[model samples]
Target: MWIKSARIVDPGQQLDFTGNIHIEKGKIKAVEKASSPMPGTMHEEVIDARGLWVFPGIIDMHAHLREPGYEYKEDVYTGSLAAAAGGVTTVVCMANTEPINDNPSVTKYILDKAEEAGLVRILPAGAVTKGQEGKVLSEMGLMKKAGIVAVSDDGKPVEDTSIMRRALEYAATFGLLLISHCEDRRLSEAGVMNEGALSSELGLPGIPSAAEEVMVARDTIISSYTSCPVHITHVSTQGSLEIIRNAKAKGIKVSCDVTPHHLLLDETRLYDYDTNAKMYPPLRTGADRKALLQGLASGVIDVIASDHAPHARDEKDLDFDVAPFGAIGLQTLLPAVLRLHFDYGLGLMQVLSLVTVNPARLLGIDGGTLKPGSRADITIVDPSTNWTLSEDMIMSKSKNSPFLGETFRGEVVYTICNGQIVYRKNGI
Candidate 1:
């Protein structure tokens, strides 16, 4: 396949230029500047990407592919399709499925399913605690052998500092990245949305910002003491960002990701009691949103993960108090993130890094690059396409996103995984 004349934005190589990408046998054969002489070769397929942006396909470090038990909400095949539709070539699925990905058997099951589907790359994250109970450490060494990219009890935070400290030490010993969900259950208990004036006005329960920041503090301190890198997931609060910033300044190995919903939406949207807007570490105040934007642009936030938690329609259609906390994000990932560049004055390359190389680096994956011999995982985006998201647009099993009906300026025109066109918009 020959992808021609596209603006290549690969932050890993620090390259941004209109170029031609040559793909052969599931690998990047060559990347040539548009101005260079064209090679004399027979091409079976050609994609003219003029006026489009070509990026290393997004690597979402945080997502929930609820397979092995919750196929009613989302399965691996459907979730991968959703991810491909959104330009994500690689996804690290959280270990929060029905049976939970704690042991090698479950991890292998997920990997085998993903291999059979053969869409995007799906790396399973093992549970940090056995059954995610937080009382005992999981079989980290065994799960690692089963091919887990990282270890995380993503749906719940480890409430005990001693347990978290031991997990950190074990992660250091095992040479695996430890991902923290970073929520204080006591502070966030019974809360449905962000805690503040808005919650009072709406007469809904609240989840304090301290619920996230306090855990961020605990994990950062533990990471510093153990000299291990801890990656905080779905960071939504300014106070948490401050703690991470301070830790990084102190030479601590720490990284974190911001979700699209956290970056684009605010607590005010919850006034209607839209359960789809509800999520763990729920949307915060406008000031927090501004800080998150700054964090992304200023490099304080390391990655732009989807946090693509999916739920059944019936589950999210209930009253706010009883509804589950999540929003389906895989299909809406790119367009929502593109707003950062269009509205927030962030450069294109910077925005691309948040979804691409930065996440790949944090997850320790061999992706987010267009160099020769690299796996041909690529996303071609039409930056000028003005599209509105609708219910039918969601490819996941559940349509739980709050961004439905929202219009955006960019769209993923083509998603290529391992040199194959897995998803193409409008039959391009």
Candidate 2:
């Protein structure tokens, strides 16, 4: 297979040029620039990717694939479909299912389901504590042997500082990354929207930024004290960014990711009881949004994840305060990211690295680069296409997305995983 004349942008190789890629046996065999053409002596699939953008298949380091439980919301197969459409060839799903992926059996179950689907690569994160109770430690060594890439309680924070410290140490013994969902339930008690004048005007409970920042502080300090790496997921506050930046400056082994929803929207959109806008570490003020953009520039933010939390239509239709706190984002991740490149004026490489090389390097995954001998996972995009996001285009079983009806300037035309075309846009 050959991808010809496309503007191949591979952050792994720090490459950006018109090129041709040759694939054989599900691996990249060679990357030839336009000036250096490969010998053409065969009849095989040749994609004329002219006037399009080719990138390393996008990798989402954090997401929720509700399998073994909550299939009504989303499951492994549906989540893989959504991932392929979003040009995400690899996804690391959180461990917050019915049984909670605290044991090796649950971890194996999720991996087995993903293998059966065979659409995209799915890695499960093991729970930090047994049943996610935050009381007893989970068998990290056994889970790691069962094929979990990391350990995290996913959406549920290990509230006990002593427990978290031990989790970090235990995870280190197995060389597993520990991802922390930094949230203090007490500080964010009964809150739905971001705390401010907007919540006051609407008479809804407000979740303060301090709720997320205090926990970020605690975890960063704990990581520093223990000298074990910690990854903070879905960071949304200005103070949290500052704390992470200081921690990094002080040589603390801590990293963080910011979701597209938190970076793109603010509390203003929640005035009407729009349930799609609700999420843990809810959207913040415009000032905080600006700080996040600046954080991307300052290198404080290491990853740009979708946090692809999906909820059913019925659940999202309820009142804002009564509805679940999340929105479907897998299909919208790429478009929202293009906004940063086209609208926010960030360099394309800098923006792409947040989703590509950065996450791949941090997570130690194998699919974020298009180098020779790597998996032939690729995404072809038309950056000039203009279209509005509609419900029918969504591949997730659930139809809860904050970006619905929003117009975007880019679209994924083809998604190739393991040298096979898994998704192609209509009429493309």
Candidate 3:
């Protein structure tokens, strides 16, 4: 396949220009600035991206593809298809599936299902505890041998400090990253939303910012003691950001990520009790949001992940107090984020790095660069295109997005993964 006349965006080298990309046998053959179309080769497909911005396929480091038990919300096939539609070529699946991916057998089961689906690259994360019970540690050695990229208890934090310490120590031996969902269950019990003026006005149980900050502080100390690579997931508070920044300054092997929702929206949106506005580490104060943006700009935050947790209509249709804590993001991540950079004064290259090279480096993957020998995983986006996000237009099985009906400034025109055209907008 040949992609011609594209404004290629390479985050690895901080370069963007009009160029041509050639792909053959599932690898990028060449990337060069072109003056005109070259002579046609035999049996080659051509794509004319005259006015689009081509970028490395977006990678999501945190996603939940529910399969092997909970197909009602989403399966590997549909989840990956949603990711492909969002211009994401690679996704790391969390370990909160129905049967919990705790052991090697379950990890292999998810992989086989993903292979059969063949829509996107699925890297499954193993559970930190057996059945995610937070009592006993899971078989980390066996799971690593079976191709698990990392270990995490996403929906639930590992509450036992001793067990968490042991997991981190064991994981370090195998060179595996330990991703933690930093929340103190005891402090967060029965908490419905952010603990502040909004929660007080609504009379809802509050989950204080300290509930999240305390766990982050604990994890940083443990990581420093064990010398293990620790990544804090979905940081939502100014206190948490300060902790991570200090840890990095102290030379601890620590990294962190911020969600688009956390960066764009805040707890004040919950004034109306909209269920879509509810999420774990619930939306924080405006002050926290500003600090998160500053952290991203100053390089304290390493990557941006969707945390694409999907729930069915029956689950999300309940009262705000009873609704689940998540919203689908894979289909809206690119457009929503583009608004932040292109319209809100954030640099284009910096915004692209949050989803591209930054994530690839965090996961130790090799597809985020536009280098000649890299895999042909590329996305073409029209940054100036104006469109409205509609729930009906999303490819995910769930319709729990917070950006429905919102106008956005960009759209993905084409996505090529592994030398194949996985997604292309109609009439483009």
Clash total of candidate 3: 0
Task: Estimate, for each residue in 33-105, the C-alpha lDDT of model 3 and write its tens digit.
Answer: 8775576597898888888889988888999888878888899999988988899988899999878999999
Model 3, residue pairs in steric clash: none
Those runs of model 1 whose alpha carbons end farther than 4 Å from true positions after fitting are none
User: Residue-wise lDDT of candidate 1 within 1-428, one digit each (tens)?
Assistant: 89899999888899999989999999999999999876646646889999999999888888999999999999999999999999999999999887989999999999999999999999999999999999999999999999998999999999889999999889778788999999999899999889999989999899999999999999999899988889999999999999999999999999999999999999988878889999998999999999998898779998888899899989998999899999999887788778888988888888888888887777777889888999999999999889888888889999999898899998999999999999999867
Instruction: State the lDDT of candidate 2 residue by residue for 1-428, as single tens digits.
Output: 99889999988789999989898889999898988956754787888899999999998889998998899999999999999999998899999999899999999999999999899889899999999999999999999999999899978889999999999999988889999998899989999988888899999999899988998999999999999999999999999999999999999999999999988898888877889888888989999999999999888999999998989889888888999988888888878888999999988888888888898888877878889999999989998899999999888989889899999888999999999998999897
Q: How close is candidate 2 to the true structure, as a TM-score?
A: 0.99
Ranking by TM-score: 2, 1, 3
Residue 117, model 2: Cα distance from true site in angstroms: 1.1
Clashing residue pairs, backbone N/CA/C < 3 A, model 1:
none
Estimate TM-scores for all models. Answer: 0.98, 0.99, 0.97
